[model samples]
Target: MSHRPRTAEAIWQAADLPARRLAGVALNPTAGTDVLLGLLACDSAAVRMTLCRDRDLPEEVVNAVLTHPDHRTRSFFAANPHIDPAQRARLVDDAHWLVRARLAQGPGFSHGRSELPEHTVVRILTTYDREHLDTLYRQVPRSARWTFPSHPEPKVRAFACDWWSELTPRERSALLADPDEEVREHALRNGRDLDPEYVERVLPDRACHARTHLLMHGALSRRVVEQVLAAPVGREDLAMIAGNPSLPLDVLALLARDPDPQVRETVAGRPELTAEQRRALATDTDSAVRTRISVHPALTEEERAAIDYRVSSDETFGRFDIPARMYDPARSRHYALSGHPLLRRRAAHDPGLPPDLVARLSCDADPGVRVLLAQNHPQAPAELLLDSFLAYTGRERWSLTTRPNFPTEDLAGYAGAADPMVRRLALLSPQTPPGTVAQLSADPDPDVRADAARHPRLSPRRLVELLDDEELAHEAAANPALPPPVLDRLVAALDG
Candidate 1:
């Protein structure tokens, strides 16, 4: 057989190597517009995702993804967190509903970035059906919600009415009398939660989620409570009634003594619990009920300490750390000073804690409290960030390094640390020596090696050597330290 040199195009067109080649090229920050455009021609979905979804693309590549024949590729681009929201919003009117829905959901993991443009938000609200609207509603930025009630689009106005409880009296009145029937109806339905008669009429006879909502959140008349009690309610219904703020003292006392421990647990959470009720539930047979009472705001720290309450490590952190616009600093301060560690964990989620509270919680015995503080507070101590990063390996572990106060001054000292994650931190330090970068490039841990390969401190000669390295090629190409001439030549070969 005659031997011929393989062309770059042939290598990229090959079945087995294309995915690797495409990934390496896609990750190359120095890859020019032409090279990126060339990679888009590759039919591999993984390549497309790596190209369009993983990193911010050049304008030409973004345009190509916008018009790509594959809707799935377009969908991936739609949810990409790296791109501008306006760029993602371009897909709002996509021919495919799935693509539009993805656009409506905004970026998959926004780290407090800007929201979609107001006009784009209105366009999605007007076009999306109920199912897509529900998804879009959750992702809508809190800043946008305040303005939605005044939006010119009726659909947007109506969408705002869904949060009627949050609206000011004036905004509610305007929506109720708005010309648009749909907007008016949404306001009426949500506002009716305050109407004792309406709640009584709509309260379902059976135990359903809607009934639970009414029993727990709706304004309950004495008659409504009596009617609910008259029915043979389930454990859930009793629990919901126990939690209702409007529950009469007699009913509250009745539920406190209910046979189901869950009902007593809910009663323990009621803000209206009498001194006697509190004393009684603090020693309830159920540990969960006692635990619930242990953190009651009404109790003194000394009183809370006296209760034999147990805090589960599992309940310490998870969704509690997610940023919420409505998070109250006062409430967080209350929790931060509470005797219970679980409440302290919740308090640590507040980003605006006073310097005193921050200092106090940074030394909290609970690891979750410290980690939550590190994850949320902008001014979280550098030591706390490093400590949390080393200790916690749960969701958003990488987020700890992104904190504003995350220490980078002496991270190179961790290069020889036993933990691979600690070893990876060495690459983040500006003071890391080139020799350490080169040494870590051959680390046994794939993640540490990949991160080291992408460090700008890696020697030019070694960076070029890694271009042929299958495992490290993509990460090496992403390194900004690659020489211009070497990068141009690589792009030229890939462009072919």
Candidate 2:
């Protein structure tokens, strides 16, 4: 028999209903002030949290909820605009740091009308949530932006660096010279018209990442570059300069043969290389350098084919579809045996790789090549599959478990694995023992239990047991194993 739909009054009168259900009822326009006032006394934090943010909450109700012991409840209440200015001011000194921080960052605190004492300003600036600082920026005064760059807190100074437009040239220069690296980096990056003399001063002392940003931002000077190169810096320092696209062709040539293969490789890919320079690099001993030179636009078709024996560059990789097929048999065989794991890893997925070579990759020391072999090779060994599953716990395990006709021998082991997702896939597998499904139905994680609830082999009795679980009830009720009468009861319970 069909029961009548619950009316608002009936829902309110049903005091035993879950607090979350009552919270939803409180949102309805028909819930009278008496019903709302009664809900304010609810023991559920979730219900009180919802009511705390309600704009239409009566002053008396707001006052009552304000005294709620839960910090989260009071935090949401403090966020409500209806709180009087006097009360809002008092809330800044609330026992909870977050509650006070929220009020300090609120509009009234930053709008010049509510002046936070210097100590309170320092406290909020140091401890307030970083996520809310972007919103706080707009509410803060123009004059106050100057104080933060020099603030004792690094985070406060770093954040204040963003408001560069508000700072005078002297303040900007001071931040540029800030003793803290992050503060100086932020100032240099965001501050405009950075003095060339200042840029030169920081070049040698600045970190590599800072130098990269400086180059990218067009802040580097020719004099600074010459000074750094003239001094005995490491190859890494030179390599960084070589990578900059703005470097002159003469400097690129000088660095091209700079002893370090890495430095030469960085120079080889420079778009400014002349045809002669490209031809010179084609014969360089470093395969990495030759690989980059092979794709240079200046190289003739013949030059590209001569060095085409190896696949080492992104352009070379891009030329082929999956199961790469461009290399010669000897080259493919060479890569399969190459000591370098990078080549062996690439060859694992090469369709042209000889069957013997492909099989050899199964024992590759690098797990990545084995992972590729497992996913692409039809006859991949069981050890390779299992090893990849346990070693690389990324999404590949899920893919391996769900692949059609995956070996039944592996299913049992995975069915008992500690990872919930691995067990979840096992529960969905046809080969998973019925006993395992029954055990997983009671797994602590709701999602794992939900997966078990949807299994086709689940017993009707087990499905019935899950009908009252708030998280899994819907999935359990829909289980094909559920008996018709039990399903009807579940649907009715869920409806109410």
Candidate 3:
């Protein structure tokens, strides 16, 4: 039974249609620059959000957004992940502080590659007031920090002074005497507060995390240590104190035998652990304590294997989804070949794995190993990414599709696959036919149907029918194939 397509008048007369039509058009990949430019004047918050934030804009549209009257519209573009970071970086000096802050925060989802230009970062650090500067500082990648101390920008060099404790003495001295007043001030500010006398004077009055910071990184005097040991701190604080490098050998031994398994676990990783302490912790009653000791640098492989440590197959790897710091290739290589799947999984977290190891791990029997590799490695094989996407339903599942090597060609074959999720992949393929897309628009699965509804190739007759469909109207309206006459009518009806 064939039905005639809805008239533009009928769609215009439909109840509550304007917002949906505008939203859909905003997402329509085929929406021309002129259509988008018309939309920019529509003054609907929902329309503005969808238009500015949801997809990459044309150069003309991007320019429109850059100078958009509404701050929210500009702010949304600042955080739009689909655009190049350079586009987002341009907003660093925007008139609105909120827009600049959004740019500082980077994209909402951390694929781990988005970063502001170094010049922009320097400008924000130098010119932004303290509150906004703090926001930018937190988003700065740890890998880039190494260059900060030597950067030509004084503000960047001053930024490195925040990690005063980690700097070499030579670096510290140089920064303290830096020609830039701000850089020298920052070095002095961080260095002065960590002195033993300053720590001792402030130890008793400091809060828990503040005290923990002093204990862990600040210069700790005997009085401060004694004060901390006598305080009624919780297990977390005790665990933190156990890992303090400045702790005396006697204190380290005492903490290794602490009743709390967590504190013992913390003490087990200490470099100062005596041979006897290591042996005792290896046989600790708690499995986690034993596992911690098993990886201690002092232990021989034979000794490490001798300990009955546990590695759960159900262990979550969410933290390892994105590489946070520079990984050591030597250590990653060693772990990649280890007998334990947990060790192999750890190795997969390294994004810079050698090609050979990447190939070897791609075939690992453990699902975690393959998924982690797919998530972390830049050159993860396309087949592995597709396989991982199909097999894993974790929160980060959709991220697989965004990977550089994820296959986009010849995916129409998945349209008829039994799994609805796999069917969705067909819509991703440019080669998928309009007939197949229309068929999927009526698919049993709502997700598959929704994806099909937005597909650019969907037939115009069905697209108009979907605009009147409550379930698919928003998606159908978003279809790039929605005719120019229909789009013009929908925009014209906006005032009514």
Q: Candidate 2, which segments miss by more than 4 Å at Cα? A: 1-198, 204-209, 215-218, 294-305, 308-436, 439-496
For candidate 2, write residues 299-412 as lDDT tens digits. 555667677334422221111224244456776676677655556666666655657886799898877677766765556666676666556665445555433334545365
| Ranking of all predicted structures according to TM-score, beginning with the best and ending with the worst | 3, 1, 2
Tens digit of lDDT per residue, candidate 1, span 214-262? 9889999989888767775675777887888778899999999998999
Better TM-score candidate (2, 3): 3
How well is each residue in 323-396 modelled by candidate 3, as lDDT tens digits?
53568888899889876566788899998898999999999988899888898888999999999988887777
Clashing pairs in 3: 24-478
**Alpha-carbon local distance difference test for all models:** 0.81, 0.62, 0.80
The lDDT ranking, best first, is: 1, 3, 2
Q: Backbone clashes in each candidate structure, one number apiece?
A: 0, 0, 1
Provide the global lDDT of candidate 1 against the true structure: 0.81
TM per candidate comes to 0.80, 0.40, 0.81
In the order shown, the candidates' Cα RMSDs to the true structure are 6.5, 16.4, 7.3
Question: Of the pair 2 and 3, which is ahead by lDDT?
Answer: 3
